[model samples]
Target: MKFDKDAWLLEAIRIKYIIPREDGTVWRRKWISADLKSMSREVHLIKQRTHKATQRVYFNLTFKGITKSVLVNRVIALAFLPNPLKLPQVNHIDGDKSHNYLKQPTPELVEKWGEYQLEWSTGRDNEKHAHANGLKTGRGSQNSNAKLTAPQVVEIRASAESPSAIAKQYGVARSTIVNILEGKTWIHV
Candidate 1:
């Protein structure tokens, strides 16, 4: 089926149909045949599957003998609105991928998602958002890869041994020792 002046269904790309946008729910459309004469324009809400690794809902679309897994969020966003920034990222407005295509996408929701979500961000904007949301935790003892605890960082700071010696004794990198001493990595100690 040809897209109705909306580019919602690109005949060249093998997109058969696009579901109507709704609030707080995901919708699906059926794939259409390439031959216009034999076209079966069956439109329905598709049931998507969540990827085990990414925890994001996706659907498989076959085009030109290649099956491509498309993310639900991106499909919904592209269907309902035009991306002004032309940035190749789709972010959930409420930080929930399960909330995909539940409501009509507004410019305000897109703007808010771009401003607040990190993975959808284009650059340092994500970092600023994380900091603002108190989600920037890769520092001091809060760092998941940290080998030493806060008390150990304090002890290391007050130690008389050289950085290299402290690093060897604590099984940490020499840079960790140097940064702790110079108040670069563990300033909280």
Candidate 2:
């Protein structure tokens, strides 16, 4: 089936936990345990909050006596859009993970918002898009684990030392030295 290029698509089994409406509101599906005598299946709107560690909005639901936390974006995708192609991931068009909802969009509004806010994508495609849009960091000297600073990379490039000697001097791998010399890792320098 053909869907709007920017439409939200559901993650697998999303319907079992939450319903994302076009209005951008997510409803938690009430789950019932077969063995429990007093379980009700009435769905209710979910109260979302930022996860402390990840700072992403999420809600929790109980299913078969077990509570599961679900991300808001995943809930939204599962509520709208068809996935005949069965792509495995969702892309936020503007690259903002926080823009998952806007005052509860109607299906029409959801489709419209999606035109500028959502798409189905693979993890690789999502990462490439993030990098292209400068939303992702950790490149070059900006990486927390970087052993060399930008100035050091520039000096390494300009140095006349052999790759092996530079590797020893910098306490880096020999391949790193080779890459620096060949304009591979530190291309910006």
Superposed on all Cα atoms, the candidates' RMSDs to the truth, in angstroms, are 8.5, 8.7
Highest TM-score among the candidates is held by which one? 2
Q: Which runs in model 2 stand beyond 4 Å of their true positions? A: 1-18, 29-43, 102-116, 144-189
- Model-by-model lDDT, in order? 0.59, 0.65
RMSD of candidate 2 to the true fold? 8.7
Q: How well is each residue in 1-189 modelled by candidate 1, as lDDT tens digits?
A: 642322333442334344535442344345545543343466556568898876788876554344567676666555555567766566554656576754526678667554332134444454444444444567655678778887898889889999999999999899989988997775544
**Collision pairs in model 1:** 22-102, 23-102, 23-103, 24-102, 24-103, 25-102, 28-45, 28-46
Q: Give the alpha carbon lDDT tens digit for every residue of 37-154 in model 2.
A: 4434687887888877666677775544445676677666656655678777777776767667533235674564445456668787877677667777787767888988878888
TM-score of each: 0.51, 0.55
TM-score of 2: 0.55
**Poorest lDDT segment (10 consecutive residues) of candidate 1:** 3-12
Position 105, candidate 2: lDDT: 38
